[model samples]
Target: MECFFKDPCFSHEEEYRVVFFQHDIDHNEAKYNQKVLFREKSGIITPYIEVRPLTSSKKLPIQSITIGPKNNVDNAQVGLEFLLIKQGYDSISVERSRIPLRY
Candidate 1:
């Protein structure tokens, strides 16, 4: 069975996620004995592991990024572009949402 699946009924929702594995975790080793970081949210503590994506290139393989419906979408686009360039990520397409968001 597929661990991750996209439902056609919820196509409008952006559900992109990255899963971490043992090999993926092995790549992100530290000089110290530190590995996972624990965080408490809503009185529940969870372990957060650092996983670096395995890509042929150094940059992430995200070709397109969609900005969801929210206030200041134009500003968000500019900020996204700046962040991409600053992070050495290139050849990415930025698009705005068309769905009527009522929030």
Candidate 2:
């Protein structure tokens, strides 16, 4: 389980993580492996894993996306909406963070 975590020292890589743990089964050899895949980007070798949703739909169960507080958040929201639409994500609800941005 701890292998899914990242150290703060790697923060400079501009990497973000999306984690999903199977709650029903302890492990699924058919679905996943301990193998970590690597790819070179911007002269940095990044480690990542391929995660497939264990559902008949075979799609990531992403229901919504909440953009965090920041300046020009509306522009960001619009861009995200356009991206979702382009990607054929019809049902996802795009929302803005209610937390007011304080400069």
Candidate 3:
């Protein structure tokens, strides 16, 4: 999914990164590793991850989130399918290119 900076004036797309989570961790949990480094450089860093829609011909972000499972299939795709099922979808078809991460 796409992520935009919380700052309204920060419109430079290069600063954004697309992250995929392996588990059900929230925004804070995901960035725990980078907390110390960021805090040292920038005082009281309050970074957040905002989920964005996936679109065709979209420019990819430099960074991505990953969890340990070591699966060949993309965990992001698997997460989407699972979410669909939980939301009462009988069957979900994930296109190789445009799988929606959220409803």
Candidate 4:
């Protein structure tokens, strides 16, 4: 389904699928929340991401990541590049985003 999380100044629209799988394990109340996990359409799991809301409503949602911690086997940068290539992303853009603590 298509879900839109938009702001007055910016908008983000994306499609996400949710499925419940049968596993041999007991369920717990703390297992699920509003937490979201993004996966590739090819069924390859990507790195773990933590999305944090901006302090001001004017900014778009920003995500922070810890790459190596999730897949500690290979170099973090190398693993990321491999995953992106497999997913058909030919290029990537890296930008420096910083917010002052006092701001």
Q: How much lDDT does each candidate structure score?
A: 0.72, 0.72, 0.44, 0.41
The candidate maximizing TM-score is 1
Q: Give lDDT: candidate 4, residue 58.
A: 39
User: Model 4 — which ten-residue stretch has the worst lDDT?
Assistant: 94-103
Expressed as tens digits, the lDDT of each residue in 18-103 for candidate 3 is 45453344556564554323223235665444444375534323132222233334875678667766755535445333222332
Whole-structure CA lDDT of model 2: 0.72
Using alpha carbons, what is the TM-score of model 3? 0.24
Residue-level lDDT of model 2, residues 16-102, one tens digit each, is 567645332765654444556789965999867787778898676787887877888989999999988887787898887665676
Number of clashing residue pairs in every model? 0, 0, 0, 0
User: Distance (Å) between predicted and true CA of 98, model 3?
Assistant: 8.3
- The digit string of per-residue lDDT tens for model 4 on 1-103 reads 2233433322222223334532326755355433436668458875334544465663333233223223233465666667656755545532222222231
Q: How many pairs in model 2 have backbone atoms within 3 A of each other, for residues 3 or more apart or on separate chains, i.e. clashes?
A: 0
